[model samples]
Target: MIYQKTELGQRAMKDRHAVEITRAQRSALILLDGQRSTASVLDATLSLGVSREDIDRLAELGLIATMPGSASADMPRGDAQLTDFASSTLAARHGPMDLPVAPNNEEERVRRYKKAYPLATQITATLGLRGFKLNLAVESAQGFDGLIELLPKIRAAVGDERVQPLRDALEGR
Candidate 1:
């Protein structure tokens, strides 16, 4: 899901807190502007050998957290019920976000697919040998639509799976 810098992270960024980190790690911290998904940040940082691990390290350091009201599993559930999107709701609400926005056409779709593909694979990869069939499904999901179809099952298998790029891609955000 989307990540917002924690107060600690913001403080570290602004005051140059003595969190020992490399340049790439700093760049990753800069990218966590609370609007971009984890995968989106990772995709942008791919040329830098990906700051994915850096992002994780930052999160572990209490430097970043999933956006509030976004159904992230890590978010403290103060009283609001988090609805699961891994079942019938997905089928019933494949709304306009599901449609390829008419502007960028196939290129836009492809770019979204590329950004989302790895996130999907990462989620499935965590499933291990038990996910052999699911892994095959991911492998077979050649296009954006195919992957979109499998989103529910992926979520169902991995409760509260953190794959915001996939959701943003689905909703055309």
Candidate 2:
């Protein structure tokens, strides 16, 4: 999922509000625009020492939120009947602005997987046990075939009761 700064984040940026934070968190705050995906944010801030932990922390603090992937992400931003909150807010505050252009779908998916690799590795490290070496396989796997090979093992590790849900998530169902 993509992440973006909340109104609180906007306020923080304008110095209208103050939130005690680390240098890394502050750097991350600068990069947390509505347009960038989580992977993009992570990549941009890697050298600044902002990690997923910081993202999670900011999320917990209500300073940021997950932007939907694919199209229609903005629908839930405001009331159910209104998907215009983002643009409306911008227009109200700063006057007219052009609508955002959506990125090409395949390219966005590739970017997502590239970012997901490290997170997958982290999960494997957390859960891979006994002779199950998902971390190594996840690190080495190149594409769909590699992911397919690992699915059963992940299912096995997580167990029958949990496997279907896990599979659905992995497949983006």
Candidate 3:
């Protein structure tokens, strides 16, 4: 998702050397760089866990630039340096952003876990049950484990039960 620069973003850009951005923001920038509308950017960024406010702020800070109508330079460019810069800034300001959390309610959790289950299952399967089970147990034994350990750490983390069924399953419940 690409977010265009608003006047605020332009103004912010004029003064700042670099503005912090979340991983989603960076991905949005890569996807919706040149000629993408603010709305598109917002949609894309939101999907990646970035808030519209953050995108707007990044624009205001001049870290992201928005152009109109398919301009090549305006297109989302995948530059490792820019991504690194944005990631670093976000880390400094808010810390690292990573996996989605287990939802609070069963329905939401199920929905979220369903979305993530395949991937988690795939990884665990690749690692083999014994290894995966052992790893998960060790991590959760301390109150959190594996991806669950990181989910609550990200900003705007959601709690879902469906996604956690695997965690429960691993615990032999």
Best by lDDT: 1
**Best candidate (score: TM-score):** 1
For residues 90-157, write the lDDT of model 1, one tens digit per residue. Answer: 33333222333333478777777777788888887887765656667887897777887777666545
Off by over 4 Å in 3: 1-19, 65-173
**Cα-based RMSD of candidate 3:** 13.6
Whole-model Cα lDDT of every candidate shown, in order: 0.64, 0.55, 0.43
Across 132-154, the per-residue lDDT of candidate 2 in tens digits comes to 34567777877534554554444
**RMSD (Å) per prediction:** 15.0, 17.3, 13.6
Better of 2 and 3 by lDDT: 2
Clashes of 2: 0
4-121 per-residue lDDT for model 3 (tens digits) = 5555445434544345555555555555444666544543343244545556556665656645443433222343243323333344444554544445566665554444445444
